[model samples]
Target chain A: MTQTSKKPAAVEALGLTKIYGSGNTEVIAMKEVSLSLARGEVVALLGPSGAGKSTFLTAIGLINPPTAGRIVIGGEAVMDGPRALVDLRAFRRRHLGFVFQKANLIPFLKAVENVAIAMEINDVSPRAARKRALELLDYLGVGDRARNLPDALSGGQQQRVAVARALANQPSLILADEPTAALDSHRGRQVMELFRQVAHEHGSAVIVVTHDHRSLDVFDRTYEMEDGELGAKHSPPAPTANSTPSA
Target chain B: MNLAAKDIRHNLGRFVLTAIGIGLLLMTVLGMSGIYRGMVDDAMVVVDRIGADLWVVQHDTRGPFAEISRVPANLEHRVRAVPGVASARSFVSHNVQREHRDEPLRMNVHGLAWPEDNGAWVTLTAGRPLGQAHYELIADASLGLALGEKLKLGKDTYTVVGIAKGMVSSGGDGLAFFTTQDALAIQVDLPGDALRLERAARVQRAVAQDLGQVQPLLLERGAGMASGIPALGPPMVSAITVRVAEGVDAAQVAATIAAWPDVSVHTRDDQEALLVRGMIDKARRQIGLFRVLLVVISTIIMALILYTLTLDKIHDIAMLKLMGARNPMIAGLILQQALLLGALGYGIAWVLGGWVFPRFPRRVLITSEDLWALAVVVAIISVFASLLGIWKAMRVEPNKVLA
Candidate 1:
């Protein structure tokens, strides 16, 4: 029988720690948290405020770096034990995308420009970037609002534009920090469902830090974070006399 | 879209207000420079209009405006006798104020030896030059006097025979030209009270030498007639101006005449340099200092505005950072905005200055060279002012967007 090699996970984090201050004032924001996600996985992170969910997201996103950790994305080690293995800025620009609590679109830029600038910064031709932006806007259902400035857009439409911008560069990972906290329940649920669709359709892993639990059912897997610790919501039961578990 | 234009369009109201504010400051700077230019021009106008190749002043003095220059009126003939001298004229210049229509009217009085063969060099805007020198004056139109109006000087009333435009003293006072006799009378004659006071003091002093005895000479002719003594008669001129012969070097002729005691000689270029660098130099420095201060203040204001504007959009900057914008890209945004504001202000101020400065009481000259120089200055200011905003933008943390 022929053996087939398994693909590397899309995202892998091991022993991620983020300690703020030092000595007497030291506070550990993340304590040796480890997580992994496969490509096309849509994972929801549910946590209380200051539960290290943001820290973990930022760490994996290569923004606020982990105090000690190794992070590998798409089989490439980007960080090793608090040291960046590659140029963080270049790596982030090419591989990572983010959506914030607020839409955070540049007020001066129209929706299409907001999306196009991401690709423009990555050295793509302006015409090609703009075309890509238009296509993404169409996919995100905001093509009609492409010419509208952020101030002219509704809250839901602006969030949709922000999502299009995050996906503009075709990043390997999409990290969202409370993206739907400002939206209505119906809109928030719709946004969560859209993230799932984006992850499967675009073949990108997605991590969403959300306080709203109503959209948990939309995620392929869910994680709970409390006091800087992370654990999966569903784990295999421990081995018993009549129980067995697969490796 | 260019980020600066987009930002300006998005906040058009605030951007325009800031530009207008900066424009007002730049206007002050440009206006000061214009005023300084006017002052320098005013100082040289009479000197240039005199049509003189050389000026003879007091030996140690700079000139009329820079110093008091007095020479004997007979020096005209001596100057005319110089080898290269074409013609020489005695000039008397003084400032006086008289009562006119119940208001004090101050004017610059010029005395020129109007020759029979058309010696007047300054242009006449409306009327002819001095046909009859005595009791006939050439007046500046800015004095609010009619062409044929009579102006009183000393004990005589002179009719305005000619109207000249833009003829004025270094101090911007309106001018009147008369013959040497009238200017002498205006310069030497004391007022009624002053004359009476002087006679009284002289009588007292004469009688003081001899106690209780007023001499017949004292009563007859104020005591000077007793000893066959003579009275001072011939009038002294302010200066002598000389025109050089066609083939003569003015500086060489001036150097020869400059050796005479109590007679300082200056070529035309020398006189111009004296008036510009010597007299108007102070005003120029004052304007220069003022321009620098205003530019500094404007720079500070621009920097503050840019910093505040950047601070207002700090979250957006962090979003850009999180989108992987380099520091230079973020700095470029702030810098471009500053440059836009500066260019707007400079353009508005330059346009308004050209329109408004002409209406000012003083002549305001705005040249393309000055505009170009100001453009460069504004460009430097804009770049320098944007540094503060650049610093703030560079320090922004991408994780702030995550938070």
Candidate 2:
């Protein structure tokens, strides 16, 4: 799992390092972190608080640039040591999707609008974007809640809508930061299984930063992080019935 | 779908209330301009109605309106003998205050030369122009005088023969028109005891002079004749209003009259300029300052409102940025909201003005040009006010969403 894929990897980060301040105030957030993920795979990142998991995730997400690193997505070198080879904002818009713990759906927009806007900003036609958004919501089992606002939806339903929004642009990489932290055990496992299903079926790579270990078996591989360094990966457990939705 | 429109729909109550608040402010700004127009219009009302080609006043004076001007009553005869003169009539004006029906009544009295000037040019809303040489007057409707109403001024009771509309002096007092003889009578009328005191004083003054000492019998004859009798041929008038021949240039006629050292000559345009610029210059400046101050206050208020609204949406803004929304798109949201607010407020101001302006003590005249200019100014203000909100939105860090 540590070796690079023969087929083009969906995400490849080489010796990524992030440093904050210098001299007396110098602090290193992440040190020489390398990660690779094949297409159609879901990976779990587990860590204690302030262990640099978020720093590493943000670096790969192109939101926060690493001080020294090479980031390649879909076989193209996008970021080189805090310098961007392409327009980072446009690249992020067209190729990456993000889901936060709070769902982060625009409060004023309905569920379908929230998802459709993600694709529309990428220059997709409104009608096609809406149609794709509805289809994604249906695939995630939140089709009936398409007209509801974020506040009107339950915790599990809101997370499902968020997932549908992340899949709106058919992105190559999906990054989720503790997406299930606000949900109960039953709802949290349901969200984690949805990520696995999204990766396996849509041929996109998925990485979830989570503290919950009860649903780690849903991922294809797991990596524990501490002291700003990523540990060795662990093999996934056998398929369990709990991975499937109860309802 | 328009993001700004959707947000407004989401919070329609707050948006509408905000627009109403802005509308009242805009109304005050618009009213300042209206009041300025009203002042200018009011100051020129009498000057316009007279329709004189040239005005002959006391030498070196701007008046009959801007300053007090008095010339000999027979100046019209001299002005008529000038080349290109069509007709000239004596005019006299003064302000009178007295009690009528237990309420204090104030009017600017204009005396028209009888036979030669019947006040036919005055626009009448009711009743006919002066039909008699005495005891008949035309009063502006602003004075609350009705047609055929008898008003007692001095010892004579004058009948309201006509009613005029929008006829007011530069000071906003309603105008009343009467024949020169009747107006002079009202000026000279006095109480019996005061008349006796004046005659005794006139006799004493004559006795002090050599003529009175040599002819005491002549002084006694003059005292018995009338109170303060001077035996002058006629009373002096305020000015002479001249109408030149149709084909004759008024300025040339005015220049001819100006050559006479006894009186100053002003063409109709010059008279209007003097009334507007010299009479109401301070009022104009005061209104202009108020208009500018209101616009500045409106801009600041709008900026603060927009800034507060932007703060309310910081979380949403950060989320949009993370979702890859462009800076222009985000900025457009704030700009559209500001413009909508301005448009709504402007509309409400017009509606409010329509209901309220007619009731004002002074006239409020609104021109189409003024309306269009205000609209353009409001649009510009909206854009400027949105800048503060746009700056705040641009500084939002997308990484904040993850935290």
Candidate 3:
């Protein structure tokens, strides 16, 4: 029998700890959190307010580093407890993507330009970046709205454009926080399924911090977080186990 | 690809309004400097046009413009006799204010040596210079005296035979050129009542003196025969302008004239320095203060404007940072906008200055050097103003996008 070799992990965090202040002022935002995501995995992080889901996402995204942890992305160590084995900002530019609750598209840039700017910021040539941006927008089903400014787009369209922007650089990991919170259930499910489709087709890992348990079936796996601690992961069909959160 | 340009396009209305506001302020600053240059140029006009190598004035005094100067009318003859002297002419200038067509007309009357000078060196923009001695004169165009127009000065009516442009005093009063005799007569002429009072005073003085009491008939004769008979000796002249012979050192002629105990001598350059450093020093300082104050106000306004603009884009900046945009890219957004604002404002100032400065009451002369200097200063101000915006942008945390 032939044996297929295991693919490399997309992102890995070991013993991640984040404490806000010292002694009397201290508040541990996240404690001993560890997770390893395989390529083509779409995971939903279900948590309540102040549950450290965003904190963990930011830490792994290299936006805000943890007080104690090791982060390895694409099988390469990037952060050793925030010591930065690599140029963190440059590394993030080339390797990570983010989507926020709001579309957060640059108001001045058109839909296509919003996506193109992401690659251009990472040193891609404008022409090539623009071409790739158009392709990503087409892939995300917003190609027809490429010329519209963010203000002119509907909420669902804007989210799709934001996703195109996130995928502009072909990053190894995509992190999203409440990306579909403002959309209706149908559009919300559509966005969650789009994330799953992006992960599967683009071979990138995606971790979404969401309160909408209605779209849990679209996720490959789901983890619940509370009081700054992440619970055990549960596969689909256990969506009711993690209750839907307040908007 | 240029984020600054895109952002400006997105908010063009506000940016243009801000630029215009800055432009008007910068125009004031430019106009102030231009006025200073014009004043200095006006002050030097007479000095330069006189074409004299040396000026001989009253002893121990800076004269002609800086202070009052008086020397014998024959000082020209004395200066002419000096070694290396080419020629000499008497120069007398004094201001006259009189009613012209219901308007108060102020003029700085300059005396030309008649047969020797003929106001030939004066640059006429219209008509001709003095055709003959006595009442024929050359009036600056600014004096509003048309060619062939008659202007009454004292007892005599002088005809304006020529019109010169930009010939004015340091005080900006237009210049009128006349023969030395006519100028002297105008200087000494008194009103009818003042003349009668002066004659009575002279007769009284004569009665008090032994000679006057013995010669009462002589006093009466003197009163009737022009009481203005050089009573304090020969009529005095303001100064003597001397030209040195070709290949003859002006400093040598000046040094020789300086040795005279009764009079002082200044080289042309010395006279110019005296005028600039003495006559209008306070005015220059006041104008300079206004210019600097306007610049400071411009800087503050720009800084505040840029800071507010940064505030408006705080969320966008955070989003860009979270997207991994470098510091240079983020800071460039603000800095480029500032530089663009400065360029646009400067351009507007130049255009507005061209349209408005000529209409100013006083001459406003903007030179190429002044323009270049102002451009450099504006660029520096733009960079400095953008610092506040750049600082705020730099401090923006990428994680704020998540929040």
Candidate 4:
């Protein structure tokens, strides 16, 4: 039963450290944080303000490089410290997905086009890509707003379209930062459940940075961060004052 | 998706306003070139109308337009007698002004040595040409002269006998043709004050000789010298235009006459060059400088607009970079938008130039070849202008999206 339950890890980081500036003004944003996430698992990262949550998210997302670390994604070793082992841009496009605090949809494009362009950049055929985009939107329950621009959609609907975009390439790992911060409690909890469903249904690993404690129960595992350090696993942990909880 | 096009459509009003501003500048650039072309045409039309193979004038002078030239009217016979010289005619040209209903009308006076068949030069659109009378005149239609209207030239009245079309002078003024004899009378004939003074002096000298106040033989000699042989003021003809016979080279004949230090002879090409290059040189330079100024102004405006537009969308550019968009792709977006702006501006200028040019007092001429050449120049300019925006875009940090 234990052998059957074991799954390959999607992301692995060893001794990840991120330092900013130098000399007297220097400060460590993330400190020797080692973490691992497995396929079909959804994890939540909760932190106080300046708790290094964004630093960890960006480092693993391949945007900002870590000061010292060994990082791997989808069984491929990609980085050593700040140096990249492969072309980072191609690596990110093929293996990783990211969602920001806001939907950040391209204003000029409709929801379907916004979703499809993410695939198009990967050299996917426009017709096939658009068909897949429609399917993803339907799966995310925003198919009715496929032709509407981001400005025309509600906050939750926009986030759904953004999630559809993030999933267009079927990436092995997803990193989201405050994906439901702008939504109401009902919508935020719904978005959190959607992330949980995405991780389980696609057999993908997901890491979400959030302060919404009400939805923390939806995650498979929860980690808390403070003063640039990750705390122990929690049956439950109260959010700090620096953390902004919607409800 | 064509990101640049979608953005432009999203901001259609701002894009249109920018295009209009650039289009007006392009229109002025095109119009200046057209005006230069028109001026060249105006300068050559009179010489072309003469249809003479050679132009003979005073030594070291370009002739009627570039400098004052005085060649004797009798020289026409000698030029006609030259080998290969088919025929020759004396021509007097000058700028004159006459009053009509209290408005001063400026015109060019062409003194034609009459009794020749050169009447075929002018294409009459109304009325008949001059009779043998000295006061009869053939006028250019642009002069707005009606048939039988009287024009006062120096103390003489001329009736407009015919109207000719497009017969303007080198300076773009309307033309009037008269007999050389009549033109000499109008230009060099003594003014009323001088004529009266001369008569009074002659009367006083005659009375002195009659009263034995002076020697009669000396008086007779002086009177014979000043005799009624009609006192002449200045030479009548400004130049002589000569035609060459069939099977003869005009240059060969011009070289033959050029041997005489007292005269300078020129072939058709020499005259055209003198008028187009020498006469229109300064005007061309002025128009060329103005055109260059307009191009520079347009380039600067385009670059500024592109930079501003790029700044406004810096967030979007950063997102694209984060999504794995390459440098070429971002640069291409900026470059493509600049090119579209140039193309739209050019099209607008072409239409506007055609509609506005004719109403100008001076002639304006544009050709398709000029338009194609300008299009190439404009395309190059757009590419260079987009570089500013591309550089700004390339500097966008993909990591900015995280913050």
Candidate 5:
């Protein structure tokens, strides 16, 4: 796949640090980590187990407040020096999306309702939320499965539904933590490709933390992590020699 | 909005089961309350039906069914002679056990003037009132006796001549009406065999008396021995019911009659208040204890059911929170489900209590107003019961989803 120049940073974090417990029992998960991602870009965060990938993702997700950091999303200074500058819950709802290892859909709800609940939490009306959810599902090529429950669909179909749910509110940034870890390689690569498509088409910056390397080519840029630090970047070879120049 | 409805639909079976359990409990509570109210109403039915303005009895006695009371029969004339007095009649009431079809039935026999001057006291539903003072009787329809049936009362057989409706004592016993003379006889008369035995024992005691032991002749010829009449006994009437004139003030008449040392007077309102006060003062504590037990049981059951439901969906609730759903929103979902269960339960209870309680052997009266009041009370209790689950749900952290 040909790559385009980064479209300008949509999310930035500096000096992010997270410590657990205190005194003799204290342990640091991440120390002075800094990173940035631009719009319409999909960045793969490759790491082994317990490599602080989850800690950094949660801190940026606004769920776990970092011990100290400066984090910015969509041109808004939401966190400065570990203190939240905005309502965390409201900000997360409006500006960020999340996909977990499991589909994590509400079991009681149908596929469409699961997608719509995100919008409803932000005070969207049911009629309008449902309409937008259907549109997103259709765009993600899972419109026919909108009426089925999460349990009734295949693993890949369920993940597609989750991706559609994350895009329902049109958030500025999407955080995916091992979203493809539960699927087989073929389905896993398919989900990664869908996330890439979502980031490009919707102009939202996407970051995926995964140990699965089979789908690494689906990402726009790949960054390796070892011992809580971003190591080196390895760009995938272009699909064809005669392909158009990188934008 | 979608979450609340979806949660309910997902667990429809469990919700229905909880509602049914609550419905059964509510039915019992409603029935008990109705039964208590019915007892009060039935107790006052006879008095209200009598429609008398005043009741005169022995001084210091509650009278009628509450206590023993007696006064001279002639007081009826004295009460009538008072200024503003319309008319007056003497009545005597006493509880007696009689045999009907070999079954012993306890009833209150009321003795009134012959030709039944107190006809207005009862409405005859069958047959006619007494024509003669001696052998005729009016019986309440509840006794299930037909006209011309003879009821044995204290060695006398009185034929039923009329059937009266709504004539019952506070004890729920049927009321039987007869002449004053017959009532006096029944009150004082003994069986022929018993009377003969008494006379024989007295003669034997006289024969055995020593001449020095107070003169045998004097013992044998006691006062009125030649006349063969027994000595006069205490005044026999149980109570005297009075109807004051249209312009008469019952309070004034009661005070004037109270001046007489041997009798007392109570207005209609006084009698009703006494009955109500008696029931409440006697049974309030017991009823309150039962009500408290019922409330406690209902709360425990509700809490258990709700807690079980919450446990079943811990993961779902965690996921919802992780998706940026506010704590209040999630709490609202649980609360809405609880309230819906309560509403369905109350509706079923109302129907069950209304349809089934009255048919009970004992009186169970449930009024519509009482039903409405209980519904509001149940709603408040339901809301309180749901609050515990809401609190538990709010304390659940979204991070628990990962765990």
Candidate 6:
């Protein structure tokens, strides 16, 4: 499939810093981090343990307000120097989605309910939420598993369901932390390809924090982080003859 | 909207266990409340059953049932002659013991005038009312007295002519109905030796005359030698129960009698208030204490249960928060679950209290209004209980999902 990447940047963060305590005992999780990602683009953030990759992801995802920074999402300057211009939670709900290391689906709910919960939280009616949830699941190729629970699905299927749930609200950006850490290389690569497809087709800016390098070529652009600072950026490697198309 | 149903489904075992525990506590609260109502009902049973509008007793006393009251038997005649007084009857009440199949039974003896005897307070599960005033008694079946059985009361042997049911005093003592004469005999009659001793003491007092009476005093003044015939004193009665005439205000009549120096009258409302104060006051306070304690305990248990459940799902809550779920949505979920638990607990308690309370030795009455009041009370408690969990859940940082 021919992939055209021409969308402009959807999120930009400059000099982001997070500090935990005052004078006597202070801890800094992330310091002076700058990043930007365009819409319809998928990027991979590679880092070692305790390298502030998770902190940077959370700061950009609007889950935690950076101590000092300028954050612009979907062309809106929402955060400036620790002050949020709009309702942080509401802005996040409308513009952002999140995927954790685990599927993190609500266990009591069925696969469809898991996805529908996101819509309901945003005040979507039950009928509309259910319809949208099923449509998203069908688009993600998991409509047949709508009635099953998270535990009933395989690891790969669970992560796919999680991806469907993240896209349920049609967010403009998606932040995933270790989304493919629990899957085999093939399944991890497959999930990586799905994220690429979602970012391009749905026009979302996708940033995935992963330790796996087997699916490095699946992303449009990749960046590395070491000790809370972004390293050199790299382009996707050219497609190889053995690069099998993912289903 | 709120994920309350989902939360309960997720932790069903814990939810059900907590509900059952709450149900048992609620059952206790409901039962105690019912018992309080029953006490009021029991205290009013005799008055309601007798259908009397006014009661006359000695001055400065509440009544025959609440306190000791005695008046001249002739007072009934005088009261019957009063305007708007349809009729008056004498009644005597005293606690007495009798033998039932070789086992002693404690009971309250109510003496009624012949033909003026009101029927039993409750339907007889087995026998009938006494047809004759003499040598016959209507006994509660709870007293274990069989029909046709002869029971010895102080010095008189009374045949159990009929069996009654639910004829119990407010103190839970069974009742037996007899003629006024028998009750007086049992209450006032003394042994021959005791009577002789009293006459001897009086004779000695009369013989020791004052020296100021210089003339020879007549020996007839002595107790032993009777003056022509001993003056007959009026018979004493416990109380006079009066039925007010149609269209007459019983309160007004009571006020009229209150003006008399040696007599006091009580309207139905006054008697009912006094009965409630005297018989059920302490029990009501005790039930109130139980209700307060149960509420405190239930609130604590619910708070702890909810807190634990919230703590258990901290990660899930954090993830939901990270996914942009609002504080109100999360809070609503917890509150809704608490309300559902409360409703379930109350439903179980209603059934349990209804089934088990009436079987107690004392009466227990449950009413729809009481249930409604309790439901509202439980709902308020549930809201308070959920506050802790909601606060904890809302305070959870979405960033914690990363940790």
lDDT by residue (B1-403, candidate 1, tens digit) is 3666777788999999999999989888889888877777777878888878888987888767677888888898998998989999887889998898778888888887866323267677878778875788888876777889987777788888888877777677888888877788888877777766666666676677773254556544553322232343345788898999999988889988988886888777888898778877877898899999999999999999999999987988898888887777788889999999999999889878888898887777666777888899999999999999998888888877754
Model 4 C-alpha lDDT per residue in residues A18-105, reported as the tens digit of each score: 9999999999999988778898788888988899999988888888899998788888888899999988888877777778889888
Native A-B contacts reproduced, model 2: 0.53
Q: Give residue B66's lDDT in candidate 4 (0 to 100).
A: 84
Ordered list by TM-score, greatest first = 2, 3, 1, 4, 6, 5
Q: Write the per-residue lDDT of candidate 2 for residues A1-247, one digit (tens) a residue.
A: 1334455689999999999999999889988888888888889999999888999999999989999989999888999999998888788887888988999888889999999999888888999989999999999999999999898999899989999999888889999999999999989999998998888888889999999888988998889888888887878877677777332
**Poorest stretch of ten by lDDT in candidate 1 chain B:** B223-232
CAPRI grade, predicted model 5? medium
Sort order, DockQ high to low: 3, 2, 6, 4, 1, 5
Which ten residues in a row are the worst by lDDT in model 5 chain B?
B223-232
Q: Per-residue CA lDDT of candidate 4, range B1-403, in tens?
A: 7888988987889988998888888989899898888888878877888888998999999987788998878888889889999989988888888688788898888877786843556889988766774888899887889998998878888888889887777677888888888877777756777776666676567667654355455434434423342443335488999989999987789899999888998877888998878888889999999998988888998899988988887888887777777778789889989999999889888988889988877778787877987798789878888989999999998787765
**Predicted candidate 3 versus true structure: per-residue lDDT over A1-247, tens digit per residue:** 1111145678888878899989999999998788888888888999899999999999999988899988999999999996889987888888898988899999999999999999999999999999998898888888898998899999999999998888888889999999999999878878888888888888889999999988898787889988778887776865443333211
Cα RMSDs of all predictions?
5.6, 2.3, 4.0, 4.7, 4.7, 4.3
Q: TM-score (chain B) for model 1? A: 0.89
Tens digits of per-residue lDDT, candidate 3, B182-206, equal 8888877888999788778877778
- Evaluating just chain A, the predictions reach TM-scores of 0.91, 0.96, 0.92, 0.92, 0.92, 0.92
Clash pairs (backbone) in predicted model 1: none
Q: Judged by lDDT, which candidate is best?
A: 3
After superposing candidate 4 on the true structure, give the runs of residues whose Cα lies further than 4 Å from its correct spot.
A1-6, A235-247, B117-119, B123-133, B136-150, B159-166, B178-191, B194-234
* lDDT value for model 3: 0.88
Residue B164 Cα positional deviation in candidate 1, in Å, after optimal superposition? 2.4
Query: Which lDDT tens digits does candidate 2 get at residues B1-403?
Result: 6888888888899989998988888888888788888888987877787788889999999868788898988888988999899999888888989999999999989888898788888889999999989999999989998888999999899999999988888777888999988877776678878877877887888888998999877588666746235564557788899999999988889889899988898888888998788888888898889888988888888889989988888888888888789999999999999999999989988889878888887778887877888899899999999999999999998898875
Evaluate model 6: give its TM-score.
0.88
Candidate 4 lDDT at B28 equals 90
lDDT of 1 by residue, A147-247 (tens): 99998998988988988888888888999999999999777866777787888888788999999877777777778888888865643223334221110
**Residue B13, candidate 4: how far off, in angstroms?**
1.7
lDDT of 6 by residue, B1-403 (tens): 4478877876789888889899999888888788888778867777887778988999999987688998988898988888889889897888877565778889888888767664444457666676776777888776777888888766678888778876777777777888887778777767777766766665566557663144234333433433222453577888899998999988777777778899998877878999888757887898899899999899889888888888887888887887788788788878888899899999889877778876788767788888998899899989999999999998899888777
